[model samples]
Target: MAVHGTVAAGFEGVCEEFASFLEREEHDPGAQLVVYRGGERVVDLWSAGVTAESLLAVFSSTKGAMALVAALLVQDGVLDLDRTVASYWPEFAGRGKDGITLREVLAHRAGLVGIDRGFTREELADDRRIAELLADQRPFWQPGQFFGYHGYVIGALVGEVIVRATGRTLQEWYEERIRAPYGLDLWLGLPESEEPRFLSTLPMLTTPEQQAELDAAPYSRFSLGGIAFNEHAPDAVELEEFVNARPVRAKGQASCGGIGSARGLAGMYAAAAFGLDGRAPLLEPNTAAEFARIHSAGTDLVSDSVKQFGLGFNTIAGSFASVAAGSFGHSGAAGSLAFADPRQGFAYAYTRRRYAYPGGAAPENAGLLWSVARALR
Candidate 1:
């Protein structure tokens, strides 16, 4: 397997590591990796099966972008983190949720994971519809008492807050304030003109043993993880199939509907932390720190495992020790990981075309990220 694209001085190790990882893969895991250092594109590489410009559905990594938009609103005083969600969207105050703050909702503490009856595909892809359904539903737990990853509906929840506050959608705010201004390849909603650039996400190809392991898992459609992902929905489809649809791509549901390349992912974070092409960074240092603070840390109720979360970003410092404290980002279901290490002054993004074994961020990210960290010294 050949690794393509260029790297800046002192970053050749990232290219070698990427190539070695690709060579070890049993399948053609087409992937893209891009990094930015202090407003400069430092590393740009992708495997042969995919191109630099390929727009892949980056699963939950989309959440990082949504979180950024929310952070911007907070920074601008358009939204207040400490304020109750009911203050912005009165309908959200139902069923003991009157006290759920904007901060708690962003931290995945509101427990509005999914609706009583799971959403249809159309409702799932439409932020407005998802919010409408969830506003009246009972939360799974007391708001802020426990934190679970709201896999599918967190965006609809946050987007609803943005809608009630600004009278416009988070998707629209993301496009106007972040994506378009930075010329990011990432899209909250992909227009028809860009359809030709999309590469449909592929499902994981697993061995018989791996398949057996997956089947043996005790996950149920009614379990917290299942409902969080809407597996309980009558019309539920595999996550890969969700964004592969044109309507999902067009709507770009904030939770998981993002479409972009590694370039866009890296660029967005770079613009957030380091500024881009002579423009100012989107977030001030204080605002970034506030969002990156570990708001929730422990066993995530949805995943049933230890995880760390900031306002909306996954705090990376806990798991990846080399990552400096306050480093933040989110990983996608298809093994995409993107983040900004403000302490290191670099932003990194890695995306794969195929679902990675064991899901979440691909294991290779550690070695790849470590290589970049070493090169920065």
Candidate 2:
């Protein structure tokens, strides 16, 4: 098990913890991790079967980037957090959703998590199509009355608002405003030239016991969780099936279509909260604070788990104590986690090629993050 890459002084424990975690994996989990304290790169490492340069499907971690774009719009006065979403996209006002605000949607409280009719794979991969379908679809719950993790459709919901307000796609704005200026490896829409570096996300290899646990609690495709992930579609596919498609990677659906290495993920957050490459931080401290404040908490209706969200990003302090509050980022379904812990003065990112058991953030993050946090201390 060859682990590739580097760490600055005081961060050797992070690498050791990573190696220890890998030793227990039953499969080659192919992972990358990169961290930055302020603008300086502190830890940069990856396991075999992946490299520092490989671009893996980052799943919902893409939402962090999408959220950043939305925050930028809010900061720029192009988008208002408190205004009705329908005020920007008139069609969104239909189906008793006229009152849903951008704040609620960003907080995953809109209840327009999915369309009852289900989305075609094509529609799910395209933000515009997804929005069109959802505009007329009824919400499963009263708008703004509750919170559920809108796993797959959140980016489309916000991206539609962005497009309506700016007359530009989220991908286009991301490229010009964030990715290109920072020279980030993370891409909302990967170009043809970058294909060689793109690594398709691998599926999870579950043990029999783990398989049984999943099988025992079967969910109807029409259930809120199932619908959020588009599992109800006639041609429903695994999470990998959607991201592995070259078309999806190329178009880069904002919710989960991003592709990048751990370095990119960490860099994105570092840039947002701290200056990078001799530049000013992308977000003002006031702006970052507003977005990182907890907007939703307690049990998540869709995932049926304890979760919390700020405006558009996941808060860091709740379940994972290693990172304190006032931090923000997101995890992908393939065990990827990326966030900036402003309180701790570092941005951390970990991404896996092989899916971790039970999905979302990988179980190994605790040790890795704890080690990094200790090293920083």
Candidate 3:
């Protein structure tokens, strides 16, 4: 599991930390780590089975990109966060959901987590289909009262508003404004030309004890967590299968389904927060502050776990010791995490082909991030 790629001068410690983690893994994780300091790529490294250009499914890390697009629209006065969702898309008014504001939806407080009848794989591949199914559905909890993680459909939920208001899909806006402009490798709607670099996500390899823990865990497909992940469906899509499918990759469902390399992910954040290639930053300081500030905190109603969210993005500082207080990003089910730390003047991304045990934001990120912080000092 030899590490590949190079680090900028004086960032040798970050490389060491990456290689050290690879040495300890029982199986090669096929991981990539990329970091940027104010638009400069400081560290770029990958492990066995993946190259710096290799694209992998970034799961919910896709949310970070989704949020950024929303932020840009907001900054440009194209979308108003305080506006009621129904105002933009009248169909959303069905079933007592007329009052949920765009702001509440961004904060995961709109309470439209999922439908009782889960989506088919085809519907899950397309954001519009997912949005249409849940538009008239009742909220699991009173909107704006309790926050739940809209694990699988937050993108579609918000994306529908984008479609209605802007007359363009969120993915389209992302491509025209962000991805294409920056020449980033990350793709919400991956093109056929990029298929060769894409690698299907590998399933998590769990130990017997871990398997036992998973089996023993209290879980039911009917529960909120289960529904959020669409486990209630008769032909539920597995976490890995969601992005691996060609349709999902091509359509780019938004909640997940993003295909990218670590370089692409990290570079996106850099371009968003620090202006890459001599261009201006995508977000103004005020817009970044608004999106990065924690809007929801405490135990998540859906997952029943402590989580904090800042308008569709994870408020990273509270969850990870090394991240700055205003840092905002998202992690994926496959152990990928990407974010921009405005205070630190850095953006970071880590992706793995093999899903890590216990899912959501691989545990290795803590040590690796700390090492990056140390290198900064």
lDDT to native, each model = 0.92, 0.91, 0.92
Model 1 weakest lDDT span, ten residues long: 314-323
Question: Could you give me the TM-score of model 2 versus the true structure?
Answer: 0.98
Task: Tell me the tens digit of each residue's lDDT in model 2 across 272-352.
Answer: 999898999999999999999999998888988888999889997776988988999998899999999888899999999
Clash-forming residue pairs, model 1: none
RMSD of each: 0.9, 0.9, 0.8
Tens digits of per-residue lDDT, candidate 1, 245-354, equal 99988998999999999999999999999999899999999999999999999999998999999998999888786689988789998999999999999999999998
Clashing pairs in 3: none
Tens digits of per-residue lDDT for model 3, 151-183: 889999889999999899999999999999988
- Of 1 and 2, the candidate ahead on lDDT is 1
Model 3 stretches astray by more than 4 angstroms: none
* lDDT for model 2: 0.91
TM-score of 1: 0.98
The superposed Cα distance between candidate 1 and the true structure at residue 228, in angstroms, equals 0.8
Given candidate 3, what's the lDDT at residue 26? 93
